[model samples]
Target: MSLRRRMCTVAAGAAAAPFVLVMLPAGVANAHGYVSDPPSRQAQCADGTVECGPIQWEPQSVEGPKGLDMCSGGNARFAELDNDHHGWEVTDVASTVEFSWTKTAAHSTRDWQYFIDGDLVAEFDGGNEQPPFSVDHTVDLSDYSGEHTVLAVWNIADTANAFYACTDVNIT
Candidate 1:
């Protein structure tokens, strides 16, 4: 095309760039995560088994300050996971169980820990690099019996925070 027309086309493209950027969502908005396997309390809500608030939309985002025992990851918005009367769905498994997590934003992992009735059952080093989009860990549960709650924590290497999930299960 002619030089003038070409210049006009370039100017139009430049003017539209800002609009395109504005239409896209922010990156920070997608930086949280949650567990799904065995169905965390928030995951139960995400799957429509239980009615919950905003956590139903972001089940993997139960993030909070590390070292806290709260199940909602210390965020009051997701505190529903901490409640025992929500009638959360339970899973039945053998002496061993598999724990999994879905990572939306791969932050450097510090460690992955599992607890049963407030006692540490399993733990693994998360390394200093970002984990895969999905992670699965096999934990030995031969020592426990009957039913119990499993609280899994994914600690971030670069932050004093962690992602939390709780799953109720019956051992066979």
Candidate 2:
């Protein structure tokens, strides 16, 4: 090869090396599990209606501590549709808030459901044969403001379990 061509090849290889090195582990890491917005350890729902930020679903096998135990299985796969409850406390009842997230699994028998203080707020059906899906919802918090707990449950009958990830929860 010509000298100029050889130099260009070497430069190109050097440039690509870092990109590959940076992206490879990320792909593998994401394949296992991940969390988007993690709450602080000292975070408190003292008023009973505290705004808990976004929460991401991850595989159980992934290292590090988790605020919510929303995982089940050896490979840390997402849960199937069933009666599984994950709870969070809301601090301020008067504040309006929005909750959003993504869901991924092999088989989901039915749609997902949202409950606030034991009341059904919404439901979602991603349809059969869909492995990955996402949804976002916003609701007034004036009624649920004080010391109430919110739960997100999957009501898919006959399924084992299911998992969900919260991308963002803005309370204002």
Candidate 3:
């Protein structure tokens, strides 16, 4: 090939490289799940609703060993989500509130649990199929009024790990 032709081809390839890359899958590049509704603390940090650090970059990555109530999925980098004094946003909700989880990557979910003041208030069987992009559950909060913190747990169906999220809410 001629020198000029080779240079032109190389430049053209370089110019189109980014566009090509965009079409391919990111391949497990980020968090598999995060609560987007009522905005989990990590999600709030991710969207700039609250000022934060590294957790803001990967909100759905707070995964840890199963059967635990600690928030941030046992990941210390996102421990800020467990701190209510971090100036987090409080979502105003009704007697019945909807909890939503946004899945970046689908997985076979075992169960979904919601806790208030360290007590399990609601639990949903995940079933056998892989969860969808947006999974939601209507939780009755009649027993809970005023400011409360909800710790949500997403247990993996086929693994020993689970994802965790926390949201502060004001029920009126």
User: Evaluated with lDDT, which candidate comes out highest?
Assistant: 3
TM-score, candidate 3, is 0.81
Question: TM-score of every model?
Answer: 0.83, 0.37, 0.81
Q: Model 2, residue 130: what's the lDDT?
A: 38
User: Residue-wise lDDT of candidate 2 within 52-159, one digit each (tens)?
Assistant: 222222221222222233322212322321112334422332355454433333233355555553466666665643334434545455554344334443333234
Alpha-carbon lDDT, every model? 0.86, 0.37, 0.87
| Model 1, runs deviating above 4 Å | 1-30
| Sort order, TM-score high to low | 1, 3, 2
Judging by lDDT, tell me the better candidate of 1 and 3. 3
Residue 68, candidate 2: how far off, in angstroms?
Answer: 15
Q: Is candidate 2 or candidate 3 better by TM-score?
A: 3
Best by TM-score: 1
Candidate 3 residue 8 Cα shift, in angstroms, is 29
| lDDT tens readout by residue for model 1, 14-121 | 999999999997553334677788788888999899998899898878989888777888899987889988888888988899888877888888899999888899
- At residue 156, candidate 2 shows an lDDT of 33
